[model samples]
Target chain A: MPKVGMEPIRRAALVQATIDEIGASGSLDVTVSQIAKRAGMSSALAHHYFGGKEQIFLAAMRHTLAVYAAEVRGALGMADSPRTRIEAIVRAGFGTTNFRREVVSAWLNFYVLAQTSGEAGRLLNVYQRRLHANLLYNLRPLVGDKAEEVAQRIGGLIDGIYLREALGTKTTNGSKATAMVLAALDLELGQGK
Target chain B: MPKVGMEPIRRAALVQATIDEIGASGSLDVTVSQIAKRAGMSSALAHHYFGGKEQIFLAAMRHTLAVYAAEVRGALGMADSPRTRIEAIVRAGFGTTNFRREVVSAWLNFYVLAQTSGEAGRLLNVYQRRLHANLLYNLRPLVGDKAEEVAQRIGGLIDGIYLREALGTKTTNGSKATAMVLAALDLELGQGK
Candidate 1:
């Protein structure tokens, strides 16, 4: 029973170690031995949980995404207004300020990795679609009849913004920038700017 | 020197051959020899014009982006209203049906590569920034006091759309889905849908 209780913690520790390595070294290609050394666990333990590098890598990616999805949902649910909700989602997307820069960089790096592999690529796409779907679901009511087209435009701009910000442009802080994007959507739909 | 000419056609032909190779075999790492063979030129002749693999790749990318950028600018310019311009830009971003799937797929693959290395990465960011800046400039007359914020938001959505679309999910393309995103923005801004 005690050994069973240790399993999740050990796996979690492995994932955390992987995240750390990626953040520090700007890559996720560090070996299980590297992760095990960092986690202070025997390499056998790493193998026991993950079976291989692919499994461990999957765990790390899934863990990061799960946290992201939960935070994004929480952000959307936190505020009453759509604008505030969108801002919250954007802020949540940035994760925490202390770990923000490295976390974002790591996420982007993993995303590119996900894009390369067929199986992992499919998984990442599903997760992202759901994330955007949730945003669209929250946004549908306010946009009325033109909601679909409006969403297309908004979605485009959001993608455009992340690429810019991720590349060191830093157009504005998360909250303010979200507000501006929302406002433009209104203007684009023939609503007030 | 005058026979083959310093004309756009030679470069265009070389770019076409490179594009075909890139699409058939994933990755932009096509060799100068490979490209020269496809372009019906001797290896030395190819080197004479393009120098090396990186240079050839950059030239091909530039050629591709130039085509895309022109289409986008034309689409936007045709519209008198900012709202209409937004619509045109979105359509242009998705690209046309002719090479839509191939081109978009290639672009997404390149995007991942650009995240890692080479002139392609640099060009990717530069072209995006230039486009965003241009959008901001055009958006100024429409947004007025809130111009900057609107620009950033617009930029984000634009980037977001491509990321979502490239993931090849119906969610990024659906009406009810996209509307929700726009609605969320509208409600956040306290504007009517």
Candidate 2:
């Protein structure tokens, strides 16, 4: 007696569960049974929805990216100046919804998966490209001819912070991470002034 | 008959083989048998020497750090200024011995392993602390009191670049990575002028 739209709901739950499981395990060695149990469903049901562990993890990553895209769009929409736009984009990286331990662990695993999986690699490239484009757009007004270089530098900083936090070498909340990036931004953009 | 002094040579070979296996696998999902086979030894011998994959990987990491330490020391010994010293350390990151495909892959795996393994975490922290200390020492003369902040940013950039190259998101050689970091240094130090 499942509803017509219940499948989507269940899939979303399973994806979230997969992220949680990976985070709890601190690795990508999660099992379908563990994810299914976390989602309050049977392994058979989870497999029915996502096929296997890789599919579930892929869906989780897609969900992560989609949320990130929306967050960036929302942040940019509210920004009024170049500085604010840049800050908005940078802040979006450490947004509460995306910076949880579970999500961060999932991100680390995603990068590792990207090394060997074509689909994961493509997703990562898209994410990087969009981030680069967004930063360049915001930076062009501030740095003139140096926008590309500045954007790449800032992009690397953001990724570096994320990578460090994701790997547990650094423990920082959103504000601290945001401050570090903004400091770099200040050095780069402030110098131009 | 085995020689009495063959242990060190065998251990070094096993460490190199471990790096090779991890690089070829593109993940730490490699087996002890695979590593042993790469070293042209039996799994039992590898186990006898290192106990397990974790111990073997730790020995490999220690070896990587030793090489990096020597490179930085050598580069520093011949340096003429703080700028050159900073450049030397940055260049050391991409040095031929440290930036090879095998070594870089091992580095990436080390970061992932750090998230779940305390030993790995300690090793990473030591590396970070030493790098930070080194950068701050070199930056203090150029930027005065702002050296610490600047050093952290530069360290993050170096790590970000390494992560990108290791993950195949970006492919850059030693000179290119050095130039990118020097550009950041120029921005920070140039602004002070």
Candidate 3:
């Protein structure tokens, strides 16, 4: 029997293990047993907590999104102006915590998983919408009526940088990634003016 | 016994079938048998032709790259200036045939596969390198010393648009996608001046 208060710790362990396992394999082709082994728990215990691999993956996805959301929120809080807010959001995206190889790999695989899993797909949509809304809100003060379009480009560029990084085509350089995006933001803002 | 001229035709069919299957399922979690059935052939024939799913997938990736290369080549031949050449390349990325949902889906899965398969990774590298070279070649006359950075931004934008499209968050609007990338190009060129 498990002790009280152990469930949350075990679930967190399992979720982190899921991310690490997916990162190592570079895909969602991992089994519950592998994740369980990595978490240092029995497959049965992992199953008892998360039901199966899909649930475990979803939990991991949720955790990744939560971390990202917190980063964005923290950055936004520190931003004093609209343009600065935009910079903050872009910087948060390429921040060390979210831009690690393992996290990026998990993100790419999650995008793939969203195709077949309804829950995963819904979670992805939520993330996309929030990101878009955040950009749009900040962009309106800078780009005026073209805020939506400019927001889309910035968002796309951020996602694009992540995808490129995931392929290992370029070394994972967060500052470089941040510069590419900020340059795009600069161009968009300049054109809008 | 098989006919002598039938090999190329069968291989082409299998490649197309493979793209369709991945697109329909939205992942590389597909089986050779499913692809074979989709091609209206037996599993043994698919196995005999490609040996396994990975080869079939690699072949499909090759076909996608070939088609994209041909489109860019055809477009570049018609371009009369360096700036127009850049336009030609960007437009070719969002061209009607290449921008179809199935092809885009295949491209995304291929990125995932590249992480695990050496051949897939090599093919992807070749595509990325060629794209960068083509963009750098044209961007030189316009941006001078900044050509490489400009080219990287443009390439990343094109890819970013495709990644966004794959999630089905927005309709697969090639014209809109093309416009966003071209706008980025325009901004980059304007800045370089």
Candidate 4:
């Protein structure tokens, strides 16, 4: 007896609103009312969709991860070689859509929340495992037996760049961040010109 | 008429308590009274010493940085080569004293706080600049023109390891973290066997 498509649109609105609210506040001290207001919806609707702040936050994190996954997939799809695949994955990390200030702030909070929340922790683990596996998959063809180590080192470098960029301490761009990763790659694979 | 030397001890206690509280709570939701209680003092005494929670957190951060700086000094003192110096610096990051659960939590929150805090941001910049400069200094003799890039890469790797270990997602030891940096080093300087 209720609207079907409206739920997805409403849910999506709440999720984006959660990101904006957390980003604007730069902390997880956001309220359901605040997010609801940002989404141009009633608090009751927001609550009905997400249940609580933690749930709302969880949903937002899932949305962020999904977008990131899609970007990585798109990048991988365009690649024909291991090197290009690696580059694509690295580039996706700092791509325009993934590197925005609000999203980075959301990521910072997500990292903090994962420290205490089991659900957040599990979500983080899944993302990290997937990233590591993907890197290892492509790296194995290029580095052979050292693929695991190379993947970890590369993954660490990417994370380090992301964390620094997210903190806004060292100014960097997508190309700059990607360049660093490639430098590490060249070092590992003897690919430097 | 207050006891001489009491202020330093009291202030140090509050800062340590702040770290402990943040570590225990895994977030910045800690109250001033909680920190004061952990420090075995009244909230009024803590306020007298630090002005408020922000100042208290700032002091805690300054204390953490000071301790890190001291470790770097000690490590650099025992260094015999550029490689050793780099090794010492990397080891210092994952050293038991600095890599404690609480200190890392404080660091994660500090990163989050820096996003919106000019003071926090500046402090982080100073710390990062010093670290980068130190790495570059040791790396120049070994890698020449590429030292700047290599230093940035190594610095990023160390940070990545610390950030990962801090999140408690993947358990890594000091030597392991240091070895990863060294692996990157070998890749950079072609020193890998």
Give the candidate number with the greatest TM-score: 3
TM-score ranking of the models: 3, 4, 2, 1
Give me the displacement of residue B164 in model 3, in angstroms: 0.6
Interface DockQ of candidate 1: 0.29
What are the models' TM-scores?
0.68, 0.94, 0.96, 0.94
DockQ of 4: 0.64
Compose the digit string of candidate 1's lDDT tens values, residues A85-183: 755665676546412545655565565566456766766876766756656765677666555565556555655555555454454456654565656
What is the overall TM-score of model 2 with all chains considered together? 0.94
Off by over 4 Å in 3: A191-193, B1-4, B191-193
Give the alpha carbon lDDT tens digit for every residue of B65-178 in model 1.
888788877887789876567556656665553134445555655664564455676888777777667667666676565556655565566566555555555434434333
User: Can you write out model 4's per-residue Cα lDDT over A1-193, one digit (the tens) per residue?
Assistant: 4667788888999999999889888898888999999998889989888787789899999999999999999999999998899889989988989887778888889989998889998998888999999999988988899999989899999888878887776568778888889878887887663
Provide per-model DockQ scores: 0.29, 0.56, 0.62, 0.64
Q: List the residue pairs that clash in candidate 4.
A: none
Residue B99 of model 3, lDDT score:
94
TM-score of 1: 0.68
- Clash count list over all predictions: 26, 0, 0, 0
The interface root-mean-square deviations, each candidate in sequence, come to 5.4, 2.2, 2.4, 1.7
Best by lDDT: 3
For candidate 3, what's the TM-score of chain A, rounded to 2 decimals?
A: 0.96
Please give the TM-score of chain B in predicted model 3.
0.95
